[model samples]
Target: MGTDVDIALLVKELCHHDAETEWIEFKTNNSDAEMIGQRISALANSACRLGIPTAYMVWGVDDKTHDVIGSSFRYRLEKRGNEELENWLHHQLTDNASFEFAEDVVCEKHVTVLMVQAAFCHTVDFERVPYIRVGSYTKKLREYPVIESEVWSRITKSDFESIAAKGGLTLPDALSLLDFPKYFDLLGAPMPQSRDEVAHYLCDDEIILRQDDGRYAVTNLGAILLAKNLKDFPTVARKALRLVQYKGRGRSEILRSKDYEGGYAVEFESAVEMIMALTPSKEDIIGAVRVQTTAYPERAIREILANALIHQDLTVTGSGPVVEVFSDRVDFTNPGTSLVDLMRLVDNPPRSRNQKLASLMRRFRFCEELGTGWDRIISSCEALYLPAPKAVEYEGAGGSVRISLLAYVPYRSMSLRDRVMACYWHACICFTNGETMTNKSLRCRFGEGGPSSSTVSKLLATAVGDGLIKPVDPETAPRYMRYVPAWA
Candidate 1:
């Protein structure tokens, strides 16, 4: 059905759902501007607090009387200098909250629908304060213990750019640690000759904001995009890339660990190249000549790195990006959650928690078109004949988001390229010597359990035929025989 039918049906059909409360309500005559605004805030904040993805307020419907009376208000009408309604509301809001107004014609009656998407956070606070309504009344959201805590957590910004540094940092002190040259280069703007002019430029661009005192303070934007050391910026420093190489499988037996940090504009390309170096490499046979190849696909590496950089929560304190190399699949996870729906991540456009952060980072070429990052990653995986990447959003108990990507193994009937991957993973699994390669294990590893033992054997046999895998035992051996990664 259309939006009109869907909108009405939601109130009727979904009304019976367990979590469904009075998420949808109506009002007619009491349309004072500020009061209406407050009601909007109350409903929006309440919807988020109540855990509903969205809430609606319709005009021309008697809220208490439940009578349908068309509203005369013209929601589409705008005044001078108020062209962007959403932007205007966002500017007024202490936090970013998304809402839409639609005038639907139901039985020739016009209804103004004010719909709000629940904050990815706990509460939608206005001016940094969560306000709620109770029994036809409104009050401080903090009046309720549970709801209050959630609101504080949700509305609070964890991004260093949003968070003020301890005591206040001096401009030069912050600049001393970062590479200023990288900033100007990324902007393609001519650098002012004077050092003080550069500081003012950074500050004016919101890269740095000086304190009330004579000294200057670098914004999180400054620290991340231009920091000499991200570590100095406590909120986001840990977000620097971290790599852990294991001798066998899990990260328990780590051989090396390093944090990737530098100017977001200057450091990303180098960081990605360095991390790729730490991963496995292969020798490709091209026209009778064997050429070395990166064990993990470069696109896969870049895609994950960009995902890490762009989608991270930046709110969770001390959390950063981590890449754990396993004998089988490589795991890369960054702190933060996808702003878009989990299932829709690959297909949908990107949504960011910190839009400003996203905007500045985009200037540095750190991300592809918003919402297209996951698609690129998937395409990259398929191009290499690797299984489609397993992308996921992890919700920690404390309410943080972490995105993960698992490298795919190659097998025959999958891809000639995947066959190469299967060899590497199978051999790598065998190299562990503890877990055996079996049909179930292979299925579980690939997230597909439909294939039987015979099919798995053929697939493994194909890998062995290519000398990509050397099974540790006979074909009849149980799932205990471990295969080493072909590199070993």
Candidate 2:
């Protein structure tokens, strides 16, 4: 049954108890929405403090009187747009939990139940940041750095697979629908002749688990990689690949669309292939003839696709992954926000929420090991003179993560500042034995009308004066001008 259904049944139990215990409580008389949200947050926070899977807030019992008054406040009025209420509580509670809300009746009296599931292992960012409730007041999470530290510490130490999802299907049920032959083909391996052997092989791969019912269940790990269709799992179906096309600059034009819906590990190759098909080609001279080539390199496509597949939040429902294709640029946005700070994305090691998903995809050769994805993505773009794909993270409401590549040559937009930046970097790429930059080489690096004989010397003098670059050569004979990584 869905969390929605379990919550309804759970509410009935709380109402029947009619007593406020340490963990069980009722709000009979008060119907204020803010009051509703606050108490729910309290109960949820209290539930976390007690290590219980769930906590209840029911109507029909008094708060101060501790007597059964049975709530008369309109709960029907509560569900109208109270998603905002739940959402408010959500921001205050810092966990990625399935926690749901429902209404039920006992003794023919109206009662509302907020069934808050356990706090998820990792820190859950709400409104793009974490929050905490103190007594009844909501406060920024960073205010209580202890709780923040505790939560963050717990998150990094937690394993992806071992996180709790009670009543979440066991591994067997999840794997039953998988197509093993497809997996074998992708791996370039022979299909096992016997069912027992096939199942055993999958278990060894951690793709399937045998449940107590003597049936096999697929782990989310297995299903995401091998399911014939991801849609079967309503919670995490078809959140892959949204492509948006534009006619002009900055997502202005409306051109085309697509959403890839299949096991990502199984279908990532197909997704990347479609993206390649979508990218436009440019003709380049080859001796006396000309050949067409894609504006962005194939390695860029592979890296972005790998980034989308590996970093998505599987727990988020309804919203799936998306890739937006513009006439001049391609914007790849995933539903979950980034874990690391934006500055560190291109430098820090690779981290992921879905360990099993990332692991299986690696074995399938979708990408190389961690920490290298950024290196590959960045180097490929810089190598081709395409501005490196930019990593953008949006943290608000539902939050979003995006990688934007300026696909079109930004001839007009390449202002003087940009040209200078590009020149400096290009020169840097060629110096220090192919590892640094120099003022003289910067002009040659862009398009080969080597800087004027005197221009190179003047530019070098200015660079040294500005502390932007240092000249290693003192002797000016042969107009010597070599440079290395200044930061190095």
Candidate 3:
């Protein structure tokens, strides 16, 4: 169940939807328990087929006009053979299927919303019979043989990365199609002397599976991670990384572009090199010397690329990971949204859609441990006094995750809000380390040199005035004043 305001906004959004989608249904005061259970099953199954995360069954909205006339139905009060409606529904569903109903009043109308978790790795069934949503109608799974077959196929087709891109290849063909030498090198293992030995090694890693016909097939994992040319495998060629550099901030003027076309393990180093080459660098002046550094940290860029490769939704076709360089920033994008919350990305253990790919990447040292990549990225930027990288979700036909690394914008050119946010994040990082933000620390964070205590004090005053941070100890001496995040 969601908050009252959330439910109201959801209901309103559903009402404005053109028509009932397969993943959503509307009912007007209908309290038929049996019918509701069946609808739930149908919607849940349809959601899985449609690749949606959740399905919805809303009451109190007109199916035609989408008007909220209110619902008289109360699911909690409904009973079935001495059992509560929700309990009975839970018992009827297979695979431990679960759902919740949220009740709220919107525009003086009572509305009830049922949120159903999609059937994952299995089809949802009630009363031992699976149901499916066909357009606006709910029908028994047996009646729709094609959908039933498709649903079963979807449920059983687990581990998309492990699926074979092509089957029935001879040993020589398999070896030729993959960069076998690099694979062994990455693993620090001696390359097998014979073709058969290498084939067995690939089979052991599940990179290639022996076919029933006695030939071998390259799995999607093998092709994506070790293929000689990703383009050779038609199924995953679109997943290759694309790098584009624009003359300016927009896409209108293209400076240069390149599509990396090898397996991730093979192309990762070259890709990083190319990205670093295209990234502009700045000159740092020391007491009597000049030092050059890339605008963005190489480690951060590498981690972001590794993340794009490992965490992307390989199920999403046509779209691939892209790196776009603009005059002021570079955006690294990958197909699909992150499985973990964006706010928790830095500290939380990473959640990946392609665990095997991630595992192999980690094994190859392409990325850090499972959960530490974001922390490194954040720390790298913080150490360089660069603005924190911005992670955003681009939603459309299919969603994407993008992280942008901004060019080194001068502190004097930053907006008030930007300065405040930077200060807040600095305080957050310091607090996490069991310390407090002081003028000295803030100056060091901003990489300001030559004793600018007053400047940093003014920055802290601005943040405090904006209520983003507060003094850790009001009684502390002004010379040793420290601050912390407002929430802290």
What residue runs in model 1 are displaced by over 4 Å at the alpha carbon? 1-160, 166-170, 261-263, 288-290, 399-408, 412-488
Model 3 C-alpha lDDT per residue in residues 59-173, reported as the tens digit of each score: 8988888889898989889999899999889888884354668888989999998977556546788998889999888999889999988877776755667656644356676
lDDT of 2 by residue, 378-404 (tens): 556665556545677887646888887
TM-score quality measure for candidate 3: 0.65
Backbone clashes in model 2: 22
In model 3, pairs of residues that clash are none
Model 3 C-alpha RMSD vs. true structure (Å) is 18.0
- lDDT (0-100) at residue 88 of candidate 1? 51
RMSD in Å for model 1:
19.7
For model 1, residues 1-488, the per-residue Cα lDDT tens digits are 01222344333222233331335556664444445455556766665555443466676666555556777766556322744544555555644354656666544666666766545444555656666756456676777787667555654533335323321234455466668888788778898888789887777666765543334445556666676667665545666767777877765688887776664665777777777777777888999999987656777677777666666666565676677776656777777666666545544556776676678777766665556666556545544545655556666632444434445453434555554454345434333445445555555544443346676666666776776666655563555554543334
What's the distance in Å from true for residue 228, model 1? 1.5
Candidate 3 wrong stretches, greater than 4 Å: 1-157, 282-291, 449-488
Candidate number achieving the greatest TM-score relative to the actual structure? 3
Model 1: which ten-residue window has the lowest total lDDT?
1-10
